[model samples]
Each structure stands twice: as structure tokens, then as C-alpha cells.
Target: MTVELRVLPPLLVSLAVTVVLAACTRVPPPPPPESREGFPERGARLIQQYGCGGCHTVPRVPRAEGLVGPPLTRFGARSYIAGELPNNAENLRRWIQDPQSVEPGTAMPDLGVSETDARDIAAYLFTLE
Candidate 1:
């Protein structure tokens, strides 16, 4: 075989590797529009209404541009909440409903989020992943 033919196999392998890597690192798309009263959508609305954006930078939430607290750009992927509690749906809900209970000196105050609203808010936060 000629030199070009000898290099074809390696070139093809490299191209395949690049394609696989690209696919692996691909970013997830945005969630679809609110569907039949989904908690995530409801939670998003509640977040805005409750002025959550006044403190934290929630991704994709309208007017969620506050800089008082930590930015929630990829909150679902975080390992901990409030830099203490493990990052989980239950923990998120608990923290949302009552921050002072979790961390006495925490800047995040108890916003009086009801259990249902807390659940919905957590659901929406997890969607950021």
C-alpha cells in the first residue's frame, strides 16, 4: 500500500474519537415549556414570585439575576447545599423551607416556603442540571 493508504486507518480512528468525545461533552438542552402543571414549571414561577432572584442567580429563571447569594447556575450538580448539607432533593426542600434550622447563622433566611412550594422549588432547581 502507498503512504496515504497506510495513514488512512489512523486518520479515521482519530476522527471517530473526536466525534465520541464531542458527544460525551454535549450540553443538555433546555426543558420544554410548562406541561400540564409540572412542579418544575410551577416552582420556577414561585421562585420569581417569591423574589428568590433577589439573592441567588438561578439559571434560566426570569429576573433571577440577584447577586446577594451564591449563583445557582448548575445547582443540581453541586455536592452540597449551603456548603453543608448534602445536595439532594429532600435536603434542598428542607433548606428552602427553613434555612436557619439547617444552619443557624446562614444568610438564607426562612422564606416561609410551604411544603408543597418547597418541593416544587427543589424540583425546579434540580432541572438546572
Candidate 2:
């Protein structure tokens, strides 16, 4: 029992010293801040990529001042889209993805935009308000 007690204290002290050394050696990095969802940024890129500016005169989009179609400056505040469908997210995405499906004789062409891209573009356009 006497032999065991002498050795146990040393072992415990060594273990504690090792733990302290490890703690002092390197500092843990601070937790990263939650990144903002890249919704607006991604939406703007998609809008420009699909050439929406070709017809619609969208504000905040460089060189998007086309006069062929209706100006989408305050699209979010608008009650209707193309004077046909409601201006909600789902409707906006549907219109962007496939305009012909929404309106038979509409001038807006189906730009073949993906569902995700359409959603993102709509999210960005909504920010106009």
C-alpha cells in the first residue's frame, strides 16, 4: 500500500502537467461567424446570366435598362406579374422558369432557367422593394 501511494501521486501529477502543457501549447481558434445566405448575390448573377435585362429594364443590374419589356424596378411591390399571374415567389419562379406555360400568347419567352436559379432570381428581385 505504501509503495502504491507514492507512485500514484507522481503519476497523477505527471498526467496533470501533461494536460496543462497541452492546453498552453496552442489556443483553439475562435468559432466562425455564421455566413449570410448568398441569396441576393446568387439571384443577381442568375438574372444577368439568363439575359433578363434583354427585355425587362431591371434596376440595380448594370446594363439592364432594356425597353422591350416592362420595367421590373419595384417588382416585389407589384400586385401582378405580366398583368396575368400573382406576384408571389412560386408564381415568379414559375414565370421565370417557363413563361409560355403561364401565358399562351405572352411575349415573354421561356428562358429555360432552372428551378433553383428562378427561385434565387426571384429572391433578388424581391429585394428591389
The numbered model that scores best in TM-score is 1
Which clashing pairs does model 1 show? Answer: none
Give me the runs in candidate 2 sitting further than 4 Å from their true place. Answer: 1-38
lDDT string for model 2 (13-87, tens) is: 999999999988976533221222237788888778888888888888877878889898877677677777767
lDDT of 1 by residue, 38-102 (tens): 39888999999889999999988899999989998878777678877877777778899989989
Best by lDDT: 1
Q: lDDT of each model, Cα atoms only?
A: 0.82, 0.78
Per-residue error for 96 in candidate 1, Å, reads 0.2
**lDDT of model 1 at position 67:** 93
The C-alpha TM-scores of every prediction are: 0.69, 0.68
- Score candidate 2 by TM-score against the native: 0.68
> How much is 58 displaced in model 1, in angstroms?
0.9
